[model samples]
Target: MHSKFKFFLFALTLYFPFTVWSHTPSDSISTEQDITPVLINAYFSQQPILGLTSSAQTINTRFLEAQQTTTLLPAVNTVAGVRMEERSPGSYRLAMRGSLIRSPFGIRNAKIYIDDLPLTDAGGNTYLNLLDPAGIHAIHIIKGPDGSLYGANSGGVINIQPEGFDVSQNQTSLLLSGGSFGLFQEQLSIQRKVDNNYNFSVDQSFTRSDGYRDNTKLHKKTLQTAHRWQYTPKNDLRFFALYSNLGYRTPGGLTRDQMEENPRMSRPAAGPNPSAKAQQAGIYNKTFYGGITHRAQLHPKLSHTVSIFGSNTDFENPFITNYEYRKENNLGLRTYFSYENIDHPQVKWQMQLGFEGQKGWYKIDNYDNEQGVSTDPQAKDNLDNIQHSFFYRAMINLYTRWTIEGSIGLNQSKIAYNHRFPEITNASGRINFGGIWMPRIATSYRVHKRLALRGSVSKGYSPPTIAEVRPSNQTINSELKAETGTNYEIGGRIETANRRLIVDLSMYHYQMDNGIVQQRNDRAEDYYRNAGEIKQQGIETSVWTYVLVPNRQRFIQALNVHSSASYNHYRFGNYEVAEQDFSGNKVTAVPDWVWTNTVLMSFPKQFGLNLSHNFTSAMPLNDENSVFSEKFHLLQAKGTWMWSLKNKRQLQIFAGIDNLLNERYSLGNDINAFGNRFFNPAPTRNYYGGMKIVL
Candidate 1:
């Protein structure tokens, strides 16, 4: 069984070489300060993950708001090869590592960013559920394909760090929440500094549900803002804006005998003209974004950064037959420059040179949902996309226990369709895709002083998004291309020496050559091809620990533990369709054990508690791995209490529970579904409670 779970995670990291001690030794910073906010937000200047060499993870939305879940799938699945899926409640899908076999939902071949602009567009979709997980305060994952310097993306790279540009001091807050099926939420936040070189922040939220099934309803609203300016100490500026409005409802997959007979049905009407809840099928969105950033230092070993962004979207769906409408717009720019040479302080070096560009335009339209009143006009298109990338990176540091890095990226993308429906005369078209080049090399070493060892070799490129070349079965394929890959990795990390146990491990192998699949056609429409090859290998692990009790009437004052695991072994190489050669099969929605665990406590007044568990295994819902999908175990719990009111104001309360072993599971399925509908049920025992107020 995966070599006895990789020899029990290598004998439990060689018998737990201690590591989890988040903070200690902060006598006002300056022991060469490096407070790991995922290594100071990795890239875009802040570095320090010791010898750094790839595979990243950083999440701290205050530990995902202690599970008062507002989705982001429980804080990005507690990171370990990452996977997040929420097939309903404003649908979201994310995968990195197994890459969701060309995601049939949102977020595809990942590459997202928030503070550093670009939320994956210009054809590489990513609507990260339109922000509002309380405006995320941090998340930085970069796993698998290091896309040379983050451009194309063969599933990896996500950086969201929003929450008013790092607040510190002036504050205001309010939050309320309710639970079970008819959940509700309201939130507000405000921050200000406005002086010592400007600062401001704002956040707004509203949420609604009634979900647990039956055309799963959901509603959302968000508004976010951040502003910061330093304008001097070598220059700085930052600004961001966001607005969102979303509407959901689309309970559409079922058949595992209608999810074992009504797991809250919705998706039944086959040869008829109704259902999808009689055509009230859902999805509606509205978005607007803005950005501006700049950082400078002219010379002090030279530095520079720049960003400018824009976005607009207005989408609508309605589906039982069709009623789609979109209107998107994009604009982007990113610039970079960096150069360093610590003048041989043991030989150090740094380099970065960058460019990024985007341009998008879409204006789809399709109609014919007779029940929801959208008569004829079967199609109307107008797409336009352009993406550009240029990247270079170099890092070197020897003597500080070795480190090396190299990177490269050069991409160019294109699209243009324009079929203004005149009854679609052969689908007017244009498609250009040619430039691609990606490369990477990494190294790290520093065995002991807490240990480290890393390695990497990378290359990946993805393309074919514009909703997978005009999807929704609207047909625009134009010989879909682009999906290259190569990756190899090795990893290690250890800790002890009084840090209480921390571990990380990695192993990877990836291969791809035109691997993009997503299909369905017995009139359930949706299509995508290429799957000539595919392969993936994996093993990932993570752990963190804590214990601490040392007296004080002991009502438990610490006891954390965190975990993550993955073991995939995907397949399908030299695949064939129609003529059916499924090569080595099994690679359909990956799963070969994925695990997560958590436990936390902390008491004595500010009380706290957390417990979690997750496990998944059975998978392969198609490509002849013959219908599989069912294997789950989940449990959750949360609790909190805080009330320190006297000037610095505070008052918190929280509660949670979810599927506490009431697992009927299928947090998202539909892999290669057509008729067998492939279940989507998920959500059984639920509960929630909340409160927050800080002024």
Candidate 2:
């Protein structure tokens, strides 16, 4: 660790030799300021940071475009108290101020949105990997539980906005990239505006790679289109459509001994069975989604927005034990109305009412796989899920400095399952999860122009997802229950008068009941069960500083430093299984400390360099807390140069390197595994280079 620190310090010293002795007039700052005004899309309204009472972060796409646009983990990791992990090339899981206990492969316990349309299905699953990074313009993350407005989520909220058409001119771009481990990617995008009222954009991307580990190959293709029309001054319409086909191999986990011996090996074969590699174990998914949103201004103080969305997914998985196929369909509608009295001089208030409804249907079939070929059908099942939620929010500002907001949401959900195998012994079941009410109250006080204080208390509730109740293990869990929790938080933000440094700090405590945890059986199959109460308390902080030396002789145009850290104290309360007292154990996968620091240097002529470092403490691997995963330190760097051509044409060349130290670590690990097989080794030192041409 000391050597690593010294290496980093030496790198910094080489770049900034006279940084400490440099001085510039405070008023002669660069035209491009780092700390600019920020506005947050708070459900129904746009609120400035000074008026916000909750913790939120926004990431601009420029940051993503500067590096490899292959995955979102790097860009999202800049945020405090957030973790995004890619187990393999195309498999990802994320958590925000929570454990990855319930997320085995995909996004769970979080609500995701693309503009005003919901991306999470009724079964509480989000296919975030379906969209390419190049198509996204911005991302907004609301940390902590926000069920009062988002509905039926215990973790957080994420809103993704896609690229929009440029009104000035028609544009086309092509990007090509290749890297180590046979990584290659191609992307094309077109943007055009027909007139003052209509605009459209289309993007397509393809990525393929032979991963660092055996049976970890990946292939993905995505196409997305977005259009907007302003029929009249008071009415507008927007549409989004997407299609994606993805296939990735899963190199199952390995025991510690196996990992140490050969980290690149795939899972070994069981008795009288083929290995994962020989069986071609992997996942194949094809999905299509479309949504339309309409906005109308009814009156001066009233407005309405409505959206309709639908999706279809065909999924197939070839595991060592069996081959599973699923056909899933989902449809949903979201509508909201807002009324505000902003004309008032002394007192201003706003009220919003909204409702969301969704339904999902799934047809699943399992078949025996004999050396990568399906032999005979083993089981068949049909599942249906429905969810409805209504929410109301009211916000008021007193004296233009004190802001208070309150919200309530009522949610209802139900599930039905039909077992179609064993003709004579067919069985069916239905469960209704009644109504759950979630409420929240938040307040913020603007102490001064450069300082603010905020506090919030909210309740979170999440029902069991379809996969949790009926997992791939071919077992139906009829006794699984919902998880509920309460969160209390207080935070503040401060900025220097010169607008060069900004800091944000927050502390939160959450207590949850009926928390769900995943466990593996003797056959390496996954299942879920309630793990009793748990408590999580933590502090999150972020700091940003910008330094500029305006002299023309200096090579550095601007230097920006952004850092974030989190400290967590998570523990289990009343957790016990099979008469064993597992109380007071540390929560699995919840690291004690996580920190990230990024340094960006801007030079002349659109040339820039970025260096980033991340550190994560050791974390428990299971409920027993007897075993733990090793801590890891990662270093990454990227450089980009842009050139301008005649007739509004441009070209950009970029290169990046990851895992500079080539540390041996597991990027993603199976949390609780049978026979203590949990390690999934990540790639060692790798490099990528790419170029983009615009016409």
Candidate 3:
């Protein structure tokens, strides 16, 4: 039924406009008008957004830029329950909601995207390694579960939207910078619309650095291209593509003494060991990912998008040990369209339908003593895995402010083995249904023109990922179930008399049943099982006010302070570990309190400064305090200046320092790469500068 309906819509849209009166060319708008709106669609929703169900919990781009953060992690870290980690500046890992240890193989939790195209790898890790944060125009994190819309991995979702094009203006921007740890970055982007209907956009970026430790170094490059064709007054078609390559080296983790005394040290071994064997000391890796996306406007306010993406990742352990991974491949396809035809004054309705699928395989090989050794026999049944999935979702909007969303999915996955292991089979996979209903009803009585009381409640659920189903060893033993939860939040937004005071407060109570947790198996003793009931309740608040407002002639215009705070209580259910009675044990890594405050001083036409302070409560690095991670505060600052000559030319300067205090702090447990070290060494202190030109 859905397929037939989709076809009908397509046919109707293809017919010449002789019979369609509602279709209007987007270009009909005055060409002199600013194109910022079309390029950044999500921003139109200023206050608590209610339109795009994808990001009911809004975090505007301006709010992020205010922090002077260069990556997605820093900008998103302040959101309650969302934690992002970086072993160094080159690697980033993120987890949303409860601190659950997702599987390390094949698409784990969390669905990620770069400009509507999936960025998730087979191992469930997002390919943030290749991204240059400066290229992003806006990002919206749906917070909580989004499995209903995007199939598989429900740990919460992040949607990134890039800049589009302008039909009336030919614009270009460039930025270059050098920072601590031998880091250097460059970015260039250009977009222009020709005539009144065709537009082109291009972007390129490169980054390289010596890194913070004994073996941390990274190099990356990216190129992006996009074309928009307004076929007619009523129809538009767009094409976009991205190419990214990344290379990095990591010095293995060290013991407690090695971490505290000399934070810049590394083990260089392939596995956990204190020995100085050069074979296992460090590792080098290279990865590449690229994809294409297409979007078409079928009718007024109705559009469809389709994308195809793939990646190849390779890594080698240059340590004394000859462990290595030659390559892993992933391919994905996605399609979705939304219809927003709420043109009626008395009643309104909107509908959204989407489907997504990913197919991929991974290989891990044991190498001979030599560097690039390969054995023909061992490569046959090779350590390989395939993950395939499909989902169907629908969201209906009744009236302007009410929404209900639901989705069901089919998942089939397996790990391949040689004939040597007849005991290993791939029939244990299972299918599941997951999604959320975020019904937001905000009645703005309007206290004058800028303030109102806004309240909302949202329910979210995340399903287990492909890796969780098939651990390192695949079998039929107790298959784990997806952890399902709800995020109930109530919040109010305030806009003051002078329009300079912006305040937001929100309280959330989260609960999960049969959540996926790591538990010591009673039978195997050392092996682990997935089982648990968990709860996390927290409150988040933010205040952004302007201490100074600049005038047209002054250029030094606004001084704003933004602060947010959160307190979360996380604990296990009636469960025990190591035969110890442990009913009230706190989960590892999920801190009890976290907060961040940023002050931004902006000069409309000249320069700007941003300073931020962040704090995280002491968290048990391991289950016991023996490996406790102490709490610490980190400070950062950045400045930007713009210069212009006369017509058609402009230059912008940017510089910043991260870890300005050089505060040594651990980013908390992410993947437990270093089993026992409570803290992962942060960079000492580094400063960087860059310049951008627009033509």
Candidate 4:
């Protein structure tokens, strides 16, 4: 028997009954006393999820509190087509639908927004780690190429909403947690409503950890506030601001032999490469971002919304190779006018027209590293980027059973750079990508009262990010073209009459041309090139149900189960490099199968237990499919007790264990490494205990 098959069978047997979980969340929490029916709402408007023509999901505060609150890694992984990894304490990588091929560290090929403000810059990069998890109240994901509305993305879109944005509640909370590996966290949140038309929220948090590996300590502090005012019956205004200071050590990747010898050791010297410990590899970053939005009702059926935002970042990185410093400034605007006729006797229609634009200025300098200090100058570059998109969308509902939607966007971008140190090409040239059109059409039909079917066709276009054009190798490649693809999808949703059982299924195929790929030179410096083509196809499904309802006579008050799975068959096409053809090989760094499950049980005396398990299959490490990582299973458990105090106060305590199986694995691996230095071992079994006070 094959070892992979045997291991898969063993894992399935170990956690089959305890593995069901759901990503779509209800508006209210489900406790021992309250079992509200699950209601999935749309992000754009007050509509039901089943009526939408696209694949979407939401994770609310209840789902976030189920996992360790220090990071969003576990909670985000529950979505079938999404993957998030934490290489070290503060480093993060995320992908949607196998989009990780172009991302080395941060988030790329996707668009991210905090409410109406853009988190992704004009250069097509997102620093996802800057936002603390405590300030994030909910996450909504559109799980395909949504460029027709968001612009310049092949992966998808993620919108992070702060607390009190969608709710009208006054509350104050404090949370403290301590865990293994010398981890500690403190957070405070305040939400207040002044009168019926004004509300505000403030969130502050601090976190520190001594990681499991050498030179991997981390600490971060963040403060965020939001305000909303309905000054008049026809006008609304909103403001958001954030500040974050973060610092973390970088324990570089290790080879298989080095990992087996000592998993806790930092990257060691090989050939001309210096040891990570000797170089004191680390990163430090400080950033500030703020935005304001206004909306007004122009007529009975017309409305207008506008938002303006700006940000600044000071970033420093001391690596084994060099010391890097960068200062970035960004500003952007988004405005739209919407018209609706939803009260029609037979047909309901709506249309939206919008324009979004952003500009950025960046100064980057590199110098020789002398024990984490900047010394001899190596290179200095100044660059600026401009991006804009005009888009429109229309949707119609016929007879309240059939719906159709269409959207189109035209995007343009330009980049100019100056090589200041070499005094060569000093702002003399610019790269312009002419206007590109992205369009999407989708339809949904209600076959029955409890069933709906949806289909969509869309186009995707993503230009090379700034990092890809001028990577660590410090070379500018102007010939690289943007990657483009067309995606086709079909999906369905089913629900029971009582809403106790719900299921969603989808399948998609995408053919991409001029795909961007990453490579490392002999000196272990990163570069990029274009692959000819790629073929991506996948199937995703999710199920959520309640096995038992709340009962007074039974010890188990309630039991809820949820499960989701993904099967991917991704391959390279027409890919040839240096006389080697990898056209038929499997895609690098993407697993063939991924499954997640979770179970929640409520007991007497306000005690509840939650258990979750994740299984990931082996995946190829390089384009040639020569080597693969090991398959692993992860198990987690948490128990909580709550008490209702006097004066409408509540106290809750939680303790949790992660990696219950203690299996060895790498959550994030360096693909196509120079010397097979790919593995970055994840943490072992750990425990955490925390308490929350709510008033």
Candidate 5:
């Protein structure tokens, strides 16, 4: 047996003695809540989960806290067909369905919103890692293309609800945690429901870690606040603000041989390229983002909502080839008007019209990197981007069992750049992507009291991001085109009458043209190109159940299980590069199968246990499909004990282990990397322990 597993078993023996010490039978049944149906705002419909005409999933706070509190990867990965990865402590990448192609790092080809505010900028980029996990109360995900409601996406949409919106009582919490690799984290949160008409929440967090690999270190601090006010009987106002300062070192990638020799080593120095440590490769960012929204009911059948948001960021990155700095500013607005016939019971209908727009200004400068110091200037540029979309949606229900909906959107985008250093003729140039129309139709029918079926056909469109247009190589690509696709999907939901068991299944086929692909040069600099065509088909399913109800006399007070799985058949079509044809090749970076399972057990005396397992199949690393990555399994476990205090206060302590099987794998890999340097090994077996106090 592995030494780590032996130590973990010994620790469990010491803890089992404590579990036997039970509390009074009159105490609370269990800290875990029963699995119940909840209302969701999917496709602008505020209805129960069973009435949706789209593939959707929701993640709550309890599920998030069951794993590590420092990162959202574990919680988000519980959703089928969704993948989130972290190359290092503070670096994050997210993908919905098979949209991972265009993204080398960060979030792309997807739309993200916090409440009604757009978190993704006009240039189609999202800084998802900046937000602390404690500040998020819930997440709602809509699978497949949703361009009719949200603008410009091929991957889907994610809406995050902050802490204050769901608070039912006033509470303050402080959490402190420490784990392997010199990891330390602290978070303080305060949520107050000031009377019945107003509520607010504040969250502050700081985290630092000396990572498992050489030259990989991370530190971040964040402050977030949210406020909601029912100023009048028919009007409501909401505001949210966040500030974050983050810095992390990049360890780079290693070859297969190098990894086998020493997975803990950073990228070694090649002929002309310096090692990651010698070059001081890292990324630093200081950003501030905020937004406000107002919702009013003009009349019984009419309503309106408007939101305004803005953000400013100062970013610095030092790589082996160059040192780059960027200053970015963005502002946007979203407003919608709705008309509904709520008074009629036999037949109901609704119509909505909305507009979303955003503009961004950016300044970028590159200099020679002399071990992280800025030396002679290399390149400089000023760029501006503007994007907008107008959309309309209509829905009708015949009786309360059948729903039909249709929607359309018109989008336009343009970019202008002025080259400053090493200038040439027409130093200023503009690229305008003409107007495009996206449409969607969907329907859902409740066959019986416990079953429902739904189907949808939607169009997907996504333009190249700013980083893709002018990649690290510092060259502009004027010939690149936007990616467009159409998706056909069918899904069903089944639930037990008591809401104790629920299952969701969905299947989709997406055909895309002008697919964006990421590439790297011999110098390890990134670039982008367009693939001719691609085809993707997949099936996703999830299950949630409560196997045992809470009982005071039972040793196992409650038992809950949640599982999700995905099967993908993704391949290239009519794709050719130079002299090589990749037609019928498997899509790079996407696995053929992925499965995740989680089990939660609640015992007497407010004691809880959680176990999670994830399995991923092998995937291709390059477009040619000549090289592949190995499959791996991950196991994680956590245990918690809570005690009630005076004045309705509480104290909790938790300890957890990740990668209990001591697997060797990469959480994030550099796909299609230069010189076959693809692997970035994840941490080995690790452990964490934390304490929290609530008042």
Candidate 6:
């Protein structure tokens, strides 16, 4: 493995070699001075990554739109090492610093995006309920691997940007919601700027939720429309069209004594009691996505951007003893070019060169006759597969504080089955390189101006996917190869110059070689091989800030505290699971200890108050299992009010309570919080309310 990844980078350059450094974020305001907004939403001097840095207690989208919660895994489980693993109610799954939270798939190692693209499915599943935060304006999380854009099995990356229309014409909004399982939601929006160079917006959303269990269920529909045109002063043309139709119902998995006796039970029980009935292990799916981007400026350092994104996925199931129907079709194309120069004084340049390609054509069908019939078979799409990839990148600007970035890529993929599953036709290729150095003398000044006793050392990479190479009604051997990973991060972050006492931290030591695990085959007990030599190391910390300064509540002006927290540690070297004895052990649904805490108090406006909490420590139910669940916590709260009836326009009313101490957790499928738990129950203390309008 390349002389053990170059002797593990020669033992982290003999232990942190003064933690590297190099700059370009305009010397980052002369070395950090209390800057918040979650490091301006995870670094953005117009997008591009390398040795990236972010902290101000991370978690900012106005602190996740202050509890407008519908996704983002429950406002990022309220920070502090994060946690959210529900499999019902607007679908959920995401866990980092602890690695794929013990895998039940979906939310695959973190990789979700709306603007920066990527919405994974086919291998790296991502289900944040297909995203819909009513045109969210910002949210950027690079998290792991210093976030060099994306590639491979992305360890973590969730960038979303919406809400644009500069000129700001009459601006409009409307929202209505109904509560308690059988819940309903609606949102409508409009923003304009015609002529003055042009800008536009049109939005839509529909939501539904029911049953705390039984077969937990939900429904969603969303559409986004955008347009921006400016031709003249440097040319610009941007247009985006998005459509999302999500259908749900997949409540299955549990056995650790039925998730500890009943974390809201469900099986065929008509999935989440909507009058209970069905439950033959039902499954439903529908998805569609679209994209477009173009920006141009021939002069001034040269500029260019071109994009094309596409998705078409469909799945419908009645059960599955082998298969009934499952489909996937995807297409992606991207092109880019940018170069901004600073004629050398301290040397300034922000360069980007790009090209990306993705294609997936999936299938599954076998009710051709009978086995576990549902009596309605007349479908044929025997299945066909195809995969592809292409990439190129760069970053450089040495001297004046120093900075360097690198990229060399080639990922060719192929899978064929023109007819008789041609032994599952397969073809592959791999090549990757990563680099980052911000070493212009590791900073010794500005430890107080908002903190920066400075330090850095970064390098990250990921590659390997195609449903991990032929998996779904399995049988292997088509020459599999490609599962490369490498990451080494030394971190530091803390800021508060009027951004409220903030603190952010990082500590990593990762190493991976020929790592593509899932080896065990008593003649097919879970196949998809490329095994051995897998060792994992971890430690990630986060603590958010903003204790008070929110508008005062109506008549009781006194109660304000907004907080966030985190802590995680994990390990496993030789590896082993399900046949127990954990070999080197320490990996069985991840949780050596994880944490989450959120507290917000308000009452000076008539409505506006919140208190939330989350924590995870003992986890390990199967794979010989450590079996020590029963140490989960969750509590929630919210309130809001504002009004001005008649002609003028304005009205708001809100209320909340979710798991308000109804503490019951289930991540992956640990079989705990219920009778045997494998997920279900993360909603016991439930209460909701809403009302809104402004014109």
The number of clashing residue pairs in each candidate reads 7, 0, 23, 7, 0, 46
Ranking by TM-score: 5, 4, 2, 3, 1, 6
Question: What would the per-residue lDDT of candidate 2 be over residues 294-344, giving only the tens digit for each residue?
Answer: 999999899999999999999989987889898999999999999989897
RMSD of each: 24.2, 3.6, 12.0, 2.9, 3.8, 26.1
Each model's lDDT comes to: 0.79, 0.84, 0.54, 0.83, 0.87, 0.51
lDDT of 1 by residue, 1-695 (tens): 25565355434433432222121111111222122323647755657554568778777666777676577787688788888888888799888887575776587777888978988888788889888877787787878776667788876788888877767668888889899999999989888887788887899999999798898899999888888888798998999988899999887888888788879888879875467988888888998989899988899899888899979999889887898999999998988899988987888988899998899999989889876678888888889999888999988888888888888888889998888885646666679888888988889898876788999888888888888888887878889898888988999877666546667798999898888889888767688988877988989988776655323356776665778888989898988877879899888988988887766665666667676667778988788888888887566778777777888777788878886656687877887887888888988878988888788
What tens-digit string does per-residue lDDT give for candidate 4 at 499-534? Answer: 677899999998888989888876667898898788
Q: Over the stretch 384-455, how does candidate 5's per-residue lDDT look in tens digits?
A: 999899999999987889999999999888999999987788888999988899999999999986799999
Q: Cα miss at 509, model 1 (Å)? A: 27
Worst 10 residues of 2 by lDDT: 18-27
Task: Tell me the spans in candidate 2 whose CA falls farther than 4 Å from its real position.
Answer: 1-34, 165-169, 424-426, 549-553
User: Which residue runs does candidate 4 get wrong by more than 4 Å?
Assistant: 1-43, 425-427
How far residue 577's Cα lies from its native spot in candidate 5, in Å, is 0.9
TM-score of each: 0.34, 0.95, 0.78, 0.95, 0.96, 0.30
- Most accurate candidate by lDDT: 5
Indicate the worst ten consecutive residues by lDDT in candidate 3: 16-25
Flag the better candidate by lDDT, 1 or 5.
5
lDDT (Cα, tens digit) per residue for candidate 3, span 1-695: 25565355334322211100000111111212121221223311233442333323445545454443345566777555577776655566666665635523212457777665778764455666566565565666655454445544445666666555333577777767777778777778787777688887787888887877766677777787767677777665665566676656545555567687888876533243323234333334555666666677788878777778887777554322334444568887777776766677435545566666666565444443233232232211233444444444444445444444444444444444342323345622334333333332222223334443434343444444433433322222334554555555555555665546666565666666666653222111112344466666766666556555444444545555556677778776665556765466676667788776666565555566666666778776544434667686666667766676578577667677777656667653433334443345777667877676777
In terms of lDDT, model 6 sits at 0.51
Looking at candidate 6, the ten consecutive residues that score lowest on lDDT are 18-27
Comparison by TM-score, 3 against 5, better one:
5
Model 6's TM-score against the true structure: 0.30
Query: Cα miss at 22, model 5 (Å)?
Result: 19
